[model samples]
Target: MFTNKGKDVVEGSSSASATDHRQQKQASQPAPLSRYESQKRRDWNTFGQYLRNQRPPVALSQSNSNHVLDFLRYLDQFGKTKVHLQGCVFFGQPEPPGPCTCPLRQAWGSLDALIGRLRAAYEENGGLPETNPFASGAIRVYLREVRDSQAKARGIPYKKKKKKRKLMKANLDNNPNISLQQS
Candidate 1:
């Protein structure tokens, strides 16, 4: 029962009308990101940059390492693309709350692409792409052509196979009864 508005709290409102009102109220309230969660994201961004600038990528848990690399990749990509690229380092975490939000990978890709475009523009305007750290090795390449190229030059990761164990010649010589198998 209502007194201030002088209207029945429930009986006065039709069931369908009440449902519509409830839906509208729910729709208007924006979901908020919590402070702790916001701080975590900020920390992640900071940590990402730290990992990226590292000349030698530090040994870390797979997920943490990947996260940092992803962030670094994004930063390098972002720096190249964003205009007024003057700073050697970006030092601050973003404000905890902002309208902008993106998945870590998506952010990385967007930033990388943006950097690529910026790098191209810089070169077009007579700026040297070679000087930019983010410039891909392929961009700096002067080679005309090659049949097969080494992956090492391109910074690709690979695993080397273990060498097969070899039997000692002395051991073979000592064992007269043992015949060597066909090679």
Candidate 2:
């Protein structure tokens, strides 16, 4: 009874376990998706759905930055963050003492992150990077505007921290003015 691992799918009462028996018969499979890949797939599906909802429906091949921008704006209606309009009294307040008539909207950070995922998904799904709506200059400028507006509304400046440069020892050795000192 123990020797028939693949040849028989007959009754089994062995301690090898039912799940184990199935695993032994199966071949090696591809690796599971990473979190980034999963998110990209979800974002891609969502963008496709949005395109389908457009008037007369837009195909992925024909969609452009304008559609992407419109989609982002459409998503603002379902946002959780409270972004006040210019006319609102709490426009520049970090936190208003009381809730007003201001509408809640998505944060600029969230929108930016969503765009990054969608951009990767677009290329992964056979889209040309140069022609990708998510990677367009219009989308970039729109994101920047959102960041600036959100920062101003929240009374905090949004700053992108620059990466620090590492000094290479090969360059130091080539230069005569700079010397390593042993204290």
Candidate 3:
């Protein structure tokens, strides 16, 4: 009976210590920042600054889809096409190198990813998911229109690569019946 009681006491103390240690550890560490949080913050700041320079300054929360559209269009003005980037790399010259076959517009995939990141950042920064302007149907439709227009202009279809299936390896040693085949 005494031995059992001692064991219970030891177990109780160890568990208590463990709980205390966990609490302490949790208190000491800060929560991890969301992915691309810094980049999102920088983008927001740049947009905010742009707004401030306008005739009438606008806050990020109060801005509508039109403002977002304008911002995206503004980004397009500075975008370099893959061909342009290649020229810059090959010639070791800055952008505005000799023109090439590709259009000057940004790639649909890159713009889509940027929008996704912005949407996530908007939600993370206290914007409601349902009302997020970045994730609005209008924005999606605009992107689709842009993509279609660019594809039509360039005569190239935009295609995303499909994820490859992972091969499952069987434990041949444990399952003696399984035979390894060399292809």
What TM-score goes with each of the models? 0.19, 0.76, 0.55
Worst 10-residue stretch by lDDT in candidate 3? 83-92
Q: Which 10-residue span in candidate 1 carries the lowest summed lDDT?
A: 142-151
RMSD to the hidden true structure, all candidates: 19.5, 6.8, 14.3
Off by over 4 Å in 1: 1-11, 15-31, 34-61, 64-67, 80-183
Q: Model 1, 1-183: lDDT tens per residue?
A: 455476656656666798899999989988876864454455544553565566776432222324433544445443422221112132122222332222222232344444454444435445454554336553223111110111222223334566444555566678887666767
Model 2 residue 38 CA deviation (Å) reads 1.8
Q: Largest lDDT belongs to which candidate?
A: 2
- lDDT values, one for every candidate: 0.42, 0.86, 0.70
Residue 33 error, candidate 2, Å: 2.6
Per-residue alpha-carbon lDDT of candidate 3 for residues 1-183, written as tens digits (9 for 90 to 100): 225644645657777999999999999999876657767777777777867776788887887778778888878867775423333333323343456554466667778878887787778778898878888888899899877665544446667676442332446556788776767
In the predicted model 3, the residue pairs found to clash are none
Model 2 residue 72 lDDT score = 96
Comparing 1 with 3 on lDDT, the higher-scoring candidate is: 3
TM-score head-to-head 2 vs 3, winner: 2
Q: Who wins the TM-score comparison?
A: 2
Which residue ranges in model 3 land beyond 4 Å of their true spot? 1-35, 82-103, 158-183
Query: How many clashes in each candidate?
Result: 1, 0, 0
